[model samples]
Target: MLTLGPERWGGGVIFDPAGYALTVSYVLLDAEIIQVALRDGRRVPATLIGLDLEPGLGVIKLEGEGPWPAAPLGDSSGVAVGDTTATVGVDADNDLVVAQGSVREVRSFAGYWEYMIDRAFIVAPYNPAFGGSPLVNVRGEVIGITSLRLGDRPVVNLAIPIEYFTATKDELISRGRVMSRRPRPWIGVYVFPGDHGVVVGGVSPVGPARQAGFRRGDTIVRINGEQVGSPEEFYRRLWQTPFGEEITLVVLRESRLHVLKVRSADRYRFFRTTGKPPE
Candidate 1:
């Protein structure tokens, strides 16, 4: 398993009267214990409630009963490019930090780790404390949750639109996942854009891809005979197929074409959803 580290820190928003907090899912992955710090300097222990991997969102319930301030949820669909926005998060000192910026772009975003968001926000002037930060509109309503910092010279933050949450919030809180949606097939390969096409960077040690003879530097050309030009296309094609199905991958390695077959599986099967580490 890949270790993110012993300790992780990120911002989150309390968006429920019952102390349910929303944040990026990566932070809570394999977490044995969670602690939430409020602006008033109160550090309260929290418990993992659920995770929605599709949009990369997670929810945690803050311990204790009394009055939690819930941020008003806003409609992200109305958010437009060039609209004023603020990225709000807490620094290491637990002090509120806000970065003023505007929506640079609102479009689809794809990551190399088999993740994609159809409607995402690209906010400018990159917030250093972006992980789990709340992107607020002019009305001070939370419109999105900042997930990652993209680009180099002119960095921008990618915010997952709030609409994704509002649509399935109840399902996540009740079942720890959306039961209505079918699980996407996961091969566990890390791929990036290459000169000719998508190239395999590495494979998960426990994922089916590793056992299927996939190697680093293998340029992927097709999935089941369908051409894949980019990482986004690769993910879309892969997810369209049901889990546990045999997947055919054609790759160019060392100037020779090789055909590899792998049976994909549900990613949750390998992930630890409980607060306790696997015993």
Candidate 2:
């Protein structure tokens, strides 16, 4: 539940006639007031409709009436690794910015913030407005949402496939999330790959891991006596365990092996859904 700042700017696409828009979920986190800037220099107030953390997408609704210009959604499943794409977004001046790039690879991506995507698009020629930008195909149909910029010299952007949103759009809009899917166990520990095992980079301030006696630079070796070699494996093991269950973790800290137990919680329950700043 870390706040990035008091105000954040990102691009979004209206996908419904009723002013419903879609953007990366990170932009909507801890948002108390939302104002959408249109191309015609008009800023319209908006409200948080819902958020789907699995796919890292968020829904918002304009506070005005009538139909809006909606972008056509494309099937991301049909997108190939070498497909061409256009990343479209707005800059700090509210001016439209578009970048042409090709999909370098389609693979799974794991983030240190306890986030993982099964199928993601890795696009080259990173766009400056990577966050919440729309990744459109040649036909101008929105296929994915650019979520992050990865790498340094050969910078690339990670786009979450759009199919994840379409599959559960209705449920997300209605219930503020997809209710059918089982919630995963989240300990809120930020980890990275290490030589011996997964290294603990940091822990969320509001997460159970903060009080679970996990120190920075602790190398996680096993979960419930099962060895974990990478961050992906650690996440898989963590999610496989039922939520609210105690998870035993063996860590190598300061040349000593220490055993720590932490109870996992649902991430959705820990985050604010009303777009109000935490008190």
Candidate 3:
């Protein structure tokens, strides 16, 4: 078991007969050390192992021997959009509680391996403190790890899909991180929304675009020699090129026409580290 403090914290029961347990990182991220209180109120020291970066999961090792009850981790891939789930965690005072909710939606972003779990028509008894709490099925098998809130609604929570755990647990447990495939080619520029067009603000050093003489503040008028109206269209065009395939970007940078051919890297690397919900 692990928690935020003697007060409010989210933890898990190590259902594994071998004593393995699961929990979320936000509950443990700032924890320099941990202590688990047994059912008998005996407190024992525990150690923080590490976390899963993409899904943001954490695992800890409790000291001393136990006959701790562990919950079986379930296959979340077997879950459907409307399936029912149970979210469990500790409240503000560290009391264990459970709330019932139906799985609402499963959304995956570009390069994301785990789908984000959303719950509808329900709310957690506890607040966002349960960042990595367990979401279980009717069979009491752990299916998801609490992750984030969808949009601006606190009641609408998200979870790191369990499949990512089953697939990467061994790797994470051993290496503390997973090596993702790198994006291969590059246009070498960062783009953002601009009035009436896409604006290039920063350039990647030694990238194809720099080699082609593209400069900052340049407006991208076309990609692949075809006219593009906006940055969205520009990105859409860039994504069309197959991975590792070289493509050309035609743009008017500082009133000069230029073309650059660049290879595309695997996109998965960018997805994991970027755009996570507030902790």
Output the worst ten-in-a-row residue range by lDDT, candidate 3. 111-120
Candidate 1, 1-279: lDDT as tens digits: 253666899999999889999999888876788999888888999998888888999999999996789999999988999999999998899888899999999899888888998999999989999999999999999999999999998999999999999999998888887779898899889899987679998888778898999998999999988999999999989998877999998999999999999999977767755453333
Q: After superposition, how far is residue 38 of candidate 3 from its true place, in Å?
A: 4.6
lDDT, residue 9, model 3:
59
Model 1 stretches astray by more than 4 angstroms: 1-3, 274-279
TM-score of each: 0.95, 0.96, 0.56
Report the Cα lDDT for residue 155, model 3.
Answer: 58
Against the unseen true structure, what C-alpha lDDT does each candidate score?
0.90, 0.89, 0.59
The residue-by-residue lDDT of candidate 2 on 1-279, one tens digit each, is: 354678898998998999999999999976778999999999999999888887799999998886899999999998888999999989899988898989999999999988898999999788888889999999999999999999998888999999999999998887787879998789878999998889999887778898898888999999999999989999899899988999999999999999999999877777776453333
As for candidate 1, its clashing pairs are: none
Of candidate 2, the 10-residue stretch with the lowest lDDT total is: 270-279
Report how far residue 221 has shifted in candidate 3, in Å: 13
| Top-down TM-score ranking | 2, 1, 3
Q: Give stretches of model 3 more than 4 Å off.
A: 1-9, 13-15, 37-40, 109-129, 151-154, 179-279
TM-score of candidate 3 against the unseen true structure:
0.56
